[model samples]
Target chain A: MNQTTETSPRPLSARIGGGILLTAAIAIAVEASTFEVAFLTDPVGPKALPLLVAAILAAGGLAQLFRPDIDVAWPESAVLTRMAGAAGSFVGYAVVLPYVGFFLSTTAVVTALSLLYGGPPLKGTLAAAALSGALWLLFVSVLGLPLPIGDLWMR
Target chain B: MDALTHLISGFAIALQPLNLGLAFVGVFVGTFVGMLPGIGPINAIAILIPVTFAAGLPPESALILLTGIYYGSQYGNSISTILLNVPGTASAVVTAIDGHAMTKAGRGGPALAMSAIASFFGGTVSIFALVLFAPVLAGWAIRFGPAEYFALMVFAFSALSSFSGGSLMRGLAATAFGLFLATVGLDPNSAIPRFTFGSLQLLDGMDFVVVTIGLFAVSEVIQLLEDTEGGQAAAVGYGRVMISAKEFAETGWTMVRGSVIGFLVGVLPGAGGTIASFLAYSTEERINGANGTFGEGDIRGVAAPEAANNAAANGAMIPLLTLGVPGSGTTAVLLGAMLGLGVTPGPLLITEQPDLFWGLAASMYIGNIFLLMLNLPLVGFFVKALTLPRWFLIPGVAALAFVAVYAVNGSSFDLVMMTGFGVVGYLMRKFSFPLAPVILGLVLGPLMEKSLRRAMALSGGDWRILFDSPIAITLWVLALASLLAPALIARKGVPAE
Candidate 1:
């Protein structure tokens, strides 16, 4: 039950403001290009929307840059590192999935993530392998998801 | 009487063996997911939508199941609130106040029973309200033009921003962010690429499901990692799921009053369950006065808020189904689902698609009955699931999410995109921006832009026509007022984040 409170006595506020400004700037830039591309198409095409969105984003970004509020708590660096690892593992699963096959890669990635998330080493590894294999069977074998069954294994 | 006739026909459709079964499944699974800490109704619906599409179920049946879960979770959310003191949705927060007190007082079983009864009463009453009000609103909405639609969308964003909690600027910023994401992909009208950034996948624009899963599910995983100690609730120790007759007598009127007040409040923009429950509970307290036990395990306390929350849930649907505008994160996800299903909900919806409208309305009644029956007798089964180990549960969910993303296009590339968005979602949560508005913007942005352009085209590019109709003017005024009024009220100091 994480309550959405702004005035908690925490030091994560300025950091959040900086992040918002950065994200908003990027959003505005990306949307501005959308506006340009829309104009290049038909005069009344989807360009108007991107342009409108971009303007709003730019305004929000400027507001954040000028007056960023402080109202968040930064988790410990270790926690962030583990989260980063989890993200990386998923990305890795996606990249190596087709080539290495669903079972092996999914097992590897899930285990790696579980370990990073503080699962006991033995339990994490076993749980990841079993969970990944079970998922493959359910979605692929039962539900028919067309998952890659590993060319290496087939060969 | 008219509603009864349509409802009878709807029952005929809902009772069809296939739809009836799907309704059961929807409520069952919805209750399970809703009971699980961190996994709310929205996530459950989004993740399962792809499965329904793959199953190729008929639209009504698909909707029956999904919408069943939507209402069913209203009953289930209270379980955690009463048993574990964890309110999965904002509505359940009120339930936890009196419910936890009852649990501590060793009347947990009675409290749980009262919640189920209150939820059922509120849901039944609200469904009646929906049937009576929806058609009336739809009839009047038939005359709405594109300008009016655009104004309505503005009202939606303005309302959400004002009520999104913490910071108005942050909420506006989140909405703006969502609109930007919506702009990604080929221009629907011109067939020209806009913001594809040379990536082919970008041509289809960002999928709402992908964003939803990332923002709600994956980000939840990241948040949980920060607190690796799993949720541990105090065990329930009540003797039986039976409320005293005296308790029922005291709470019956409170439940009725809460339903009426909550339904009305929920109909307004920017008034979410938080406001609805607060108003209902406070009103009940005031009405009861000295005779009423306002806080010390008052049965009415449980009934009032529980009824109001459920009614507010149904009330929130008015704008979503009839006006294509959502007042909260959960309804925003629903709007996304409708769009994904190729169902455009707007003023013309009722007239153009009576079956979808009336069928959905009828199915809601079925869903409510199913939810009550499911929660009442089968409570023990749901509580057993609470013992599931986090190791198995968390990884299983992640794997399912992976499959869902892959199912979207049957591509690993989508998984990559999902992971990236997951990171972005986690960051957004880490920051203080509201995620619901982003989903709202992404879903509604294209439609809003389309309406704006169409309005201009019809008016020969005359901007003044945007303010022509009284309805449209009123909507615009409300939208502006929603944005400015909150800031004016909180003149103490602006939120920093």
Candidate 2:
């Protein structure tokens, strides 16, 4: 039985997608189970939409589970690296934004992404800096939109 | 006559210097952004919403600018489709077929010119239709109760889900996820928290600007990076930008027919430019089958889809202006922008904000004129943009997207959420899930919930009140019909023209 389990292979992504969805459905249903209103805002309360969403999700998930398998075409390893690196840069930009401010963080991220996109490093840096500077002038200086000037720099 | 008077005043407002300048900038930017391969109309409009808001322009001006981006995109969409054989937006997919064929045949210039002319024809003709039909629909929709609004929104969700993507189940899942996201903030009625998981940042709910930029723009950047190894495109110069007089006369009727077909389909709850262009091209082919070259480098081939798609873009506005419901993903984002601008679009919208409605209608005509002027002499200039390296183009857009998302709340938390949503969006796109329905579900979810609850409360907890009215019943029927529509369309094999 253990050998068969090892040989059965991981289920199709349909099953995994379905499993994740089903998990969300059960979680929402359980969470809605705990929703208590002090006064009935309405007879149905705020529970109705969430319940309806859970129902739709469960139906879709169940259909995927029972339906014929469809495999996800995962990106190749090299391509995966590029995608991960690009996505990570965006997340990293968000974390560093408060500490380093808009212009520096934006310029750095853009330059790295530009280089990854295969531009020459020096040209990419110049272009990234110009674009970031222009956007900062537009947003902060001209448009008067408040952007963080970096807490570290302030201190 | 009443419409004429309204239109005249609309022109008066649109002609104002600031509004006119904004309109021009909108179309110009719309064209420039739409010329980029991965950046379509939805991304262009989504990326600009925060900027327009941060600038503190009037709601009407913002609407004008955004809508200009909406329709002007059709004019620009054909450029890349013809040049690269890669449609910039989904609606231009059909345009790519005969358009690229024309380019390969060395008739790219004539094909582009025909597309521009057809787009202009579709744009001008549909503005008149919008001017005529919007008021009528608004007047009729004034009688809708809360129950009816809920049913109508359901119809919209079903329609977009069924039409926009490959599988019905995937679209619905994306929609369910969007509705779940919509439920993240405080429960409006009882003032209870939901799905927030004890974070103050989630309390005010997901901002559409942040969500949209993350979904449309950020996902696009990731998608582009997956294929970064491709070499640069060789510059394809469209030789000359003039359609022969004889060719224009030949395809004149083709343009008119496509415009009419596109306009009517676009007004329907779920149908947008994709179906409209397909229907228009197939119909024109059938009509011209006697001696015509459709799949070849036929000028009429380029004319039909271009005309249909542009007309459909304008036609989609009718429901939005009249009933306050947007039919497609792009318009759903527009609806969110309008809501953020504090403009509640509904039956009272025309009467209450006549300036907004009429001025938008007027500016569209003016925008179309500018589009023709811009696309005609400057085809070479725009096509040269196709040669721009991905590294330069992709990162610039990503930076713009980052700024837009950050500008929304001035919080790094929103930026993190935006990045998370970007990853989610990237996964969704890979899985062939339709992103539009998700946006529609999020933007309309609260309103649908509110209406459902209000109706239930009004009827003292009887859920049957949702189906009690004839109008609500009709809408419920439409919703069910649209859900069954794709299967039926597939069964019939995409309709024989």
Candidate 3:
């Protein structure tokens, strides 16, 4: 069902998203066409699926471009900052995990996320440390899945 | 007779101490995760996949645990819905209407009791139906050629995209995106790297666990952070969760109808517990007409949706186990887990690996019993768990997710990819794009492509071969019809959502 009563112009965000999707679809098609096969493979080669996917994406993009739904209400800047912080902490955790080890890096990222969710510093860090330790025990000591022990320490 | 014999031997395996213990843990953790806001069965199951893989359990045991979480969550979802007016999952959304109304009227105990009983009834009925129907469907599908399978997958995509409760275009776009993700890394037929972007790790293809955790769990953490208005803790004093004989008698028929509707709807690709519960609630509302207090604390209102959703949860397993096709996102995750366990489910699974099939079926019965016992008497303990501070809980979940993603390939690169998908997932949610179809597309994409290529190869590249067989033609028609069904339903003023 149409959410709005009157026909409103397509939202700028939807148009931009659609344009990106369309461009990606063309790019996929072009890339797929260049997939050269050395010998005679199956009747439908690897490119068939990608080309089909490109066509479907193009159709979706064209639909969005012509008739976009209502504009999404993006979160306020404060909330956005928190989300970005959380995402950044996750990326940072990945980057530092090998250097700082699982326990330290996991605790840091979890504490960072906790603070973003309004937890106090002292308690958040404690909880994060406890959680990270417990996970290490479970994954390493119990299940015996090998997690990184920090290249810094290993060296 | 053969099915009964298999089920008997299955019970022998299910009753083993190890399988039973895992079943208990599965339902217990399932209830806990399902009752919490923002953490659903999908996240719990996804996060546990790596652990299950590491544990090196038999395929049957793994399936038992994962499917326990699948159905057990249905029972747990109503706990928060009734007590806090917060639905634990989308399937529980309808339950909140009557369930919370009952709570407001000081009848929360009876409401919770009715929900448990209804869930138990619906679950048991659907499991029986699953036992009876799976074999018949598998036998029928045994004749299906690649063309038929290709068409069936198309039907699944169309049904999911149309029924995912959004504009069809966005759903299609999401599905395309998932399929595109599936096409990443090395192509299955050829060794060509299609979209690896010159990365070494990309050679293995995009792992479903990585994508699932990122899109569902990681995005969930981000979304929860955006909402500053934290939910207030629910009161635990709801008296004993027991219903009167009269109340049970009144809801007996309601539970039956809901179970039937839920099971039938769950068998179809795309529609799951959410739609099943809605249909059951509306049907009961219409049947009651003027005399019914459908929305305002009616006991039947509580019974109808709870039963339907639980039954629908169990009903979803039939396709997953028998057809190797998942009808909903949760089942899609289950299918992925099944694949990871080195068990391929299809028509032959019943005949070939009867132990796995029957063992799972038997464990479901045990799992449902565990759910009833846990929900009926020990629900207070669970309600107290709802008071777990969001700060501790959310980050804990995130850490678990982090471990699971890292465990996928033991590479930090996956972690980076996970964060990227998380942002994309958040943006998709903001724009009202459904995420389930994306998973469905990702899980089913490879199979669909293989089927298409096989079918085309058989016909020497003739496209019309796709429509050659009667079954293939029928599936094509069904796919086209499903795509148009939502539009027609909307035109008739039916609230499809």
- Best candidate, DockQ: 3
| TM-scores vs. true structure, each candidate | 0.91, 0.96, 0.96
At residue B222, candidate 3 shows an lDDT of: 91
Q: CAPRI verdict on model 2?
A: acceptable
Question: What tens digits encode model 1's per-residue C-alpha lDDT throughout B1-497?
Answer: 87678777777888888888888888887888777777777777778777766666767777787787787666667887787777876667777888888877888788888988887888789988988898788778888899998999899888887777667767887887788788788877667777787899889989988888888778877777776655654346754877889889888899999899889978877746767787788788788858865676777888998888888888988888888877777888787777767787776777687777777877787777887787778877776666565655676678778878777787888888888777778777766667778888888888888888788778767788789999999999999998887677568563311
lDDT of 2: 0.84
Summarize candidate 3's per-residue lDDT along B438-492 as a digit string, tens digits.
Answer: 9999999999999998888788888998999899899899999988988999999
| Winner on DockQ (2 vs 3) | 3
Docking class of 3: medium
Show the colliding residue pairs in model 1. A13-A70, A13-A71, A69-B496, A69-B497
Off by over 4 Å in 3: A1-10, A37-41, B234-237
**lDDT for each residue of candidate 2 in B353-388, tens digit (9 for 90 to 100):** 899889989998998988888889888888777688
Please tell me which predicted candidate would have the highest TM-score against the true structure.
3
Considering TM-score, which of the candidate structures 2 and 3 is the better prediction for this target? Answer: 3
Candidate 1 vs candidate 3, TM-score winner: 3
What alpha-carbon RMSD in Å does predicted model 1 have with respect to the real structure? 3.4
Give the distance in Å from residue B255's predicted Cα in candidate 2 to where it truly belongs: 0.9
TM-score of chain B alone in model 1: 0.94
True contacts kept of each: 0.48, 0.77, 0.73
